[model samples]
Every structure is written in structure tokens, then in C-alpha cells.
Target: MIEQLGPPTLFFTLSSANTKWPDLHKLFPKTQSNTVHHNRMQFIENLVNNPHITTLYLHLRFQIFRDEVIVKQLHATDHWYRYEWQHRGSAHIHGFLWLPQAPNIDNLDSSNHESIQSVKNLFDQYITTWNPRTEVDHLNKQYIPAISNPCLSNTGVISRSEPCTDYTELVNVVQCHMKCLEYTCLKKNSTLKCRYKAHWPEQHDSSLTLDHNNNPSYKPARNDSRLNVHNPMMLAIWRANVDCQAICSKKAILQYISKYVSKTEHKSESYIDILKRIVGLINSEDTILLAYHRFMMGIVADRDISTQETCHMLLKLPLISCTRQFVNLNVGKKIFQL
Candidate 1:
């Protein structure tokens, strides 16, 4: 698609499993226990017991996003998306969108100030890292109670009548986008640096700059360096952690997307050692059926199946969705025939 349609306009990731969502909480039986630990355990138990509900909810949310946001809002000409399960059994989506009208960084001239400004304007229209709380406080000049789980709060919902409704929702949802120094983001055996290269210096105005490889990069104006890029409308509706960014370097972004979507299952060193031992045990005298059974057992033993993924498979849900269909074209065969 990149060869035919140029480069995608945006790349996004949507994560699921908001434990504090009112609808998800309602799935559990009414409990008198108000303790945080007890509620958390109960939620986990419910998820294990009812995996279908979790997967179905995720699928439904993705459908809504595809229809409303991608098609209607962004007016994407074409798109591709894939669903993957996290280590903890939750589901998330990785997607790419091709917008005909959006500026393509690959075609932009870095030296042209007008061209750079146009790209920045398009970025500011959808992506933002600024916190809405700063604007709210500037206008209200009062303190609002901090909401840990904004999805459960009534004020988190955007309303036309309430002037601060959108601001409150933006403030609460943006809080979820804050970047933390977790093990996943940190360099192996090192606590000082982030693996994803986050925590960029604060920029007062959005600008386009060339990366180390001389590829055009768009940097959104940000007040808080710890926050991730997000779309305010998406945050208000999805009410979960979301990452939205413009596709800057076509080669680099395509490489990343391909690697991420085709990533294989993570296997531990112990699992590899066990598989090798099982392979070594196969003997020439052993019956074909018995050897096959033993090998199958070894493979099954090494497999990691999460409750949500199992439920998704049993329900016969598709692992991917795309606006266009693809077919293999054998150019080598045509060349030989000619």
C-alpha cells in the first residue's frame, strides 16, 4: 500500500482493559467489600472466569473506533489494523491510516518554513501533548478534586451544557497518557534511560525537524515532557491509554510497523532448553505415532495461551481488519511465461 498510496498519514495504538470503567465494574456481582485489594482481586477473578466478555468488549470498541473515528472523522482512504494479546491477557490494536488530505512528511522540504508550518498546523489539529488542566485552572482559578479513575467519574463525560466538561475529560484522560519509567520502557539492566526514547525536551511551539537520519520529524508543542501524544476526542471517547502519532519517516515507520505486527511469541530460555531436551530424546527405534505424540507434547508444553486470547479464538473473532483486500501476485511466474 505504501508503494501505491504513498505513506500512511497516522499510526495509532489503542489499549483495552480499563478496570475502573463503570460498565466493566458492573459485570461483577454486587460486593460489599470496599477495600482496594479485594476489589482488584475480584476483578481479576471475573476476567479469568468471563474471558468472552472482555474480548467482546474490546472487539466492539475497535469497531466503533473504525467506523466513527477512522472513517467519519479522519476520512481515511484506506487503513489496516491488527489485534494482539498482551502478556497479561488483555487485547490491544495497532493500526495505520492513509489520509488523502493530510500532509506527508516525506514530501515536505525542511528548508521551506511555510511547508513546515502547514505540517505543524495539520498535526496540531488532531494530535496534542498539552494538558487541558492548565487552561482550566487558568480560567477557573480554583482547585478540582483529583480523579484517579476518570472513566468512573461523571465529570469525565463531555457535555455541551457544561463549559468545562470537555476540559475536565481531557485533563482526566491525558493523565492516563503520562509516561512512567517502567521495566518495559527501560534499557535492559539499566534504570537511567528509556528504551523507546521518550522524555523529549519541552517545546513551546510545534515544529518540524530532521532526525539523526535526516528524515523529517514532527514535534508537537508540549508543556509536560512526561505526557504521551494523544487525540483529545479519542481520549474523551475511548477513555483508555492511546498513542497517536503522524507518520514522519516512511522507511523508518514502515519498518517499525512491519516488525511489530509480525513479532513472534516470546519464549524463555528454560522453554528453549526443554524443547532441545525433548528433541534429543527422540530415538530411531521409537514408533512414528509415539514420536509424533512426544513432539506434540513438547510443543504444547511450551505454548502460552492467555484466557482472553483463548476466548477470542473460541468465539471465532478475526485477529485483524483492513479496509482493502490483498492477493499474492506471482511476478516471477509471469516473467518466466513471457
Candidate 2:
């Protein structure tokens, strides 16, 4: 809680299969099933029991924490969020918000032109790199940011007569590598062309600068590698790899969303990947992608051990101050038929 609910003025990431879920073509409709691995395991179990994709994923997680049109459209005062299921089993949402009259980074006064135009009007009203000339802005054209530069992969034991360094001391740093040449190079070689290189040519348009932890964020334009964005309704209900940002401090967005909210289980494989997944020798689409990544990592580790035993029995219970307003705790408006 960033030392008891303080830092975090917007930071976002929400994903759960994109193309705005039509529930696997409306509950497995296109199937001419020849046991195409049991029609892709009944189309991933009817796209995970889709009741309109769990009612638009619980109405976009309760309109991003109780909507008054998204709390006056992101003027949001307080929020903290976590939900991860990934490993291709979708549902990834890491949010943090706390505007509190935005811009007060230790009293920012960068040669005060009204405090740098109030931090460039809070990064032009909460981030944009420019990509939606409105076709009803269909979610900023799925976050444009293209890339074919995966450390320029030709991974057949390096041999490209060397010569490809120029990272220029990691320009705006955010580096991670490994996984060579699937659709072409992101890593695996000694050189570098683009994980985020080729001289930063991808952010589409939205620049205020300073953030590689120096704070004062917002920088979006990039074309040659493609990264222009301006979130069309959070990429139309969190489809694209939406990563809205603003927070520069609060210990760097609390060590970046607490490394995706207590991330662990990098891997586990006891009986040699479970006897190659119980003698079937895997490959039924990699055993339905390893049983949809171990059934959403065992339902997110049993909902984090039942939310830490209901926060240790509500810290040995003893406080109840009910005013007049009862009900509506908003369990995402409770519609769970499936």
C-alpha cells in the first residue's frame, strides 16, 4: 500500500484475450470438430464459461472501481488493484490510482511555467501517444506500437560478422531478453537492434519526458517500431496490451505493481513435466497449453489462500461501524451464473 495508501496516480494494464471477446465465436460455433483436439478442448471450455465473457469481465471490474463514469473519468481519488491469471489464461489487471488533485510531486516547480503547465496537464489528461483519429476510436487501433526488432534474431549461432552494439547506454531503460527468433529476434546473440532500440523510434506522440524514474512522465510517439497510443476506452475494455502510466514515484509504482502482485512460480515440473503430461506426450496443443497454465495457476493459488484466510479472520474481528448505507459492496454486480 505504498506505505499506507499514498503514491499511485494511475498505472494500468488489463488484458484478457483481446478482439473484445465474442466468447470464442459465440460459444464454440465454428466447430467442424474432427476431435481437432476435441475442438480445442471445447474451445478452451467455451472461452472459459463465457456468459458474455463473465459479463464483460465483471463489467470491466466494476467500471474500474465503482464508476461514476470511471470516477469522474479518472479524476479518481483512491484505488488499488490486482488480478493476474495470465499464462495465456487471460485476466491480467494491475491498477493503482490516487489522483488527489494530481501533480504534487514533492511540489514540482520545474522553472515554473505554472509548474510546467501542471505537468503537461497531467500528461494530457492521463497519457496518450496519439493513435486514434476516431473510427469511434476503436481502442486506439489496438495500441499501434509495432516491432519486428527482436535483437535482430538470426539465432543460428550468432554469425552475422558481428557489429551491432549501439544501445547508447540504454536510452530510456526497460530491458529484458531471452526467447530468440520465434517471429524474429527479441534476444539471443551479442548485438542489439530492437527490444527498445534503433534509437527509440516508436512512441507515436505524447511527450513531456523525465520518466526513467526521474518522474514527470508521459512520452508516447514512435513509428518505425510502432508505439503510439491514446487508450480508446482502455483499449476497448482492456483488449490490447494496455499499459497506461503516470506514476513516477511512490517507489517507482511500488516496485512496479509489486512485481505483478507477488509474482512467483517461475516454473515447476516434477515428473519430467509430469511424465510428458501423463504419457500423451503433450501436444494436444501442448495439452491445451498446459491445461490453461495449470488451470489458471490453481485458480490463482486458491485465491491467494482465500485472501489470506480472510485477512486472518479480519484481524481477529472486533470493529463494525455501519452507518445508513447498507448493501452494494459491489461484487462486480454479482452475476455469476457460470
Candidate 3:
């Protein structure tokens, strides 16, 4: 009820008369047209099924190995404002390979189709709001600078005048891959982050094809040299259950609280000073403090907990007068929910 229909619905659904009647279609746009909104909802849906979405693959799938040996290459020099206007720099040998996978979106075909269509529909949907004869048609022609740039392609680089449908597809593929990795992390025991990309020559074209020798035709790995991004594994940490320590260690609880606090992004005179704000009030401000405490409580509470227990644990001040408030909690909306 809160996430969908949202807050505005309550305002209108309860009170009929208003001096200013706003447009409902704009706020409650047709579900078909809101790709971003749908993607967000879909992502939330995916999180419920698995916290570690395939996106976690970036941290789990690839490995990048580095060596300290430095080699100097005489490439084109550009006179930049930085580096004292020096054009020469040394490159390190970071060896790696980029492997591709046929991603499985819950092994469902419709999910894959929707993921792809979301990218296209978003672009097309935007064009619909503009005047077709002038602004829309004129903007379409301006894409040649990015699409037809000979300088980047000939040199084994893939640069676009603008990030187009193809670029969006590539991004979605990466995101889906990461989400899968996140799924693995949650079920297992590791924190992962992906930071790899297909190499220069292989990435030179949108086709992303390779030759018989398994090398990019335009920009071979030998020409570019470094290979660290080949396999996706980037960062790893121990993954355990969400840390809840109001009844356990205060330190671990502090770290968990820090993650939540960082989301607020308040400025202090300096860092590490969060102690000044959230420490002693662990009991009061039940509105905000208890809200999060209740959310964290959800981390460990089993599905069978009675409504009275849940309401007391989470909502220190319940909005509803009845004892059935706990019946409203659903499984899919929160990051750590079922």
C-alpha cells in the first residue's frame, strides 16, 4: 500500500473534495510507459528472491592479477593541462581476460525480453513527449558524431557520440551479471564487487566478436597490453547474516548503524564523529530510531512471529489502533525481507 498507489493515493482515496484537482495520469502514469519505475520495481522484486543478484558476478567471476614491472610505450602524446603538460607515461602489466556468459534471468525468457525492451522503451517513451516533427526528428540526426566516429573505432576503441540502445544493453547485461553474484554472496559467505570490462580490441565494435585466434581484429590485447580486467572478481569480504546487536555486541551494531547513517549523508566537523548524534538516543525518537530498529529486527525474526510481537518490536508507536498491524508486513519490499 505504501510502495504502490503510494502516499498520494491515500490523500485522494480518503478525501474526495479538493480545491486543486491535479492530473492523476502524470503522477500515476500508465504502468506500460514507466520503464524506470518498472525497472526499479523489477529490481526490488529480484532482491526479494535473492539479495545477491547476478550483479555480484563482477566480484565473483573474474580475477585481475598485477605485476610491478613497468614498461614505457611511445603512443600519441596529448598536451594536457595536468602532469606539467607531459605526454609520456609508463604502463604497468596487469594481466587478465574478459569472458562472456549467456546470463540466466531466473531461467525465464520473458524476464530477459522485458530487460531488453526496458532499454528501448525508455528511449522511445521519452521521444513520445516531444514534438515529432521538430525536436524529436532533429535530435535523432545529432547522433552521427558518436555513432560514426572513425577515430575511436580505427584505434580499437569503442566510443559513442551518445550512450545508445546498444550501450544500454551492455550495461543491463553487466547489471544482471552483478545481481547474480549478489545472490551467490548472500547464500554463501563473501562480499563481492565487479570491475572488469571486455578488452580494447574486443570492445572496439558493438558486435564484440573475435577472430579465429580469439583476438580482436581492430585492437588486439598485445597492442593494448594490460589484461587485469579479464575475469570479473574485484573485491571480496566475509558475508554473514545482517549484523543485529542491540542484544549482542555494540561495536558490530555500530558498524551496521553506520551503513544506515551513511545513507543520510550528514556533514560533521569531521568523520568518525557519528558518536555525537545517534548514541544515547537508542531509546527515544521512536519515530525514526524505532523505525530502523524494527526494520533491523526483521532481519532475524521468523515468519511465524505474532502480530503483537512484531508491532511492539518495530513500530514503537503504531499508527493503527488495532492489534493486527503486523498483518500488513509483506515479504518482498525490503532489501532483507523474505
Off by over 4 Å in 1: 25-38, 135-145, 154-184, 189-191, 268-303, 330-338
Q: Could you tell me which residue pairs clash in candidate 1?
A: none
Q: Model 1, 86: alpha-carbon shift in Å? A: 2.1
Tens digits of per-residue lDDT for model 2, 1-338 = 44555566667665544223332334344545422222344555555444344435433454553365335765566665555554423445666666667765656665677776666677566665443233443334232222222222222312332322212111111121222332234443685445533234444345565655576655555432333233444543333355667765566665775775586744544544544444443344556666556545444343333332233234442111111233555576667677
Candidate order (lDDT): 1, 2, 3
Please report, as a residue range, the 10-residue window in candidate 1 with the lowest summed lDDT. Answer: 154-163
- At residue 172, candidate 2 shows an lDDT of 11
TM-score leader: 1
- Provide the TM-score for each candidate, comma-separated: 0.75, 0.26, 0.16
User: Candidate 2 — which residues are off by over 4 angstroms?
Assistant: 1-10, 17-20, 23-44, 48-107, 110-113, 120-122, 127-230, 237-243, 257-338
Judge candidate 2 at residue 250 and give its lDDT.
60
Considering every candidate listed, which one attains the maximal lDDT? 1
Worst 10-residue stretch by lDDT in candidate 3?
9-18
Query: What is the clash tally of candidate 1?
Result: 0
Clashes of each: 0, 13, 28
lDDT of 1 at 154: 37
Candidate 3: stretches off by over 4 Å: 1-42, 51-56, 60-294, 297-338
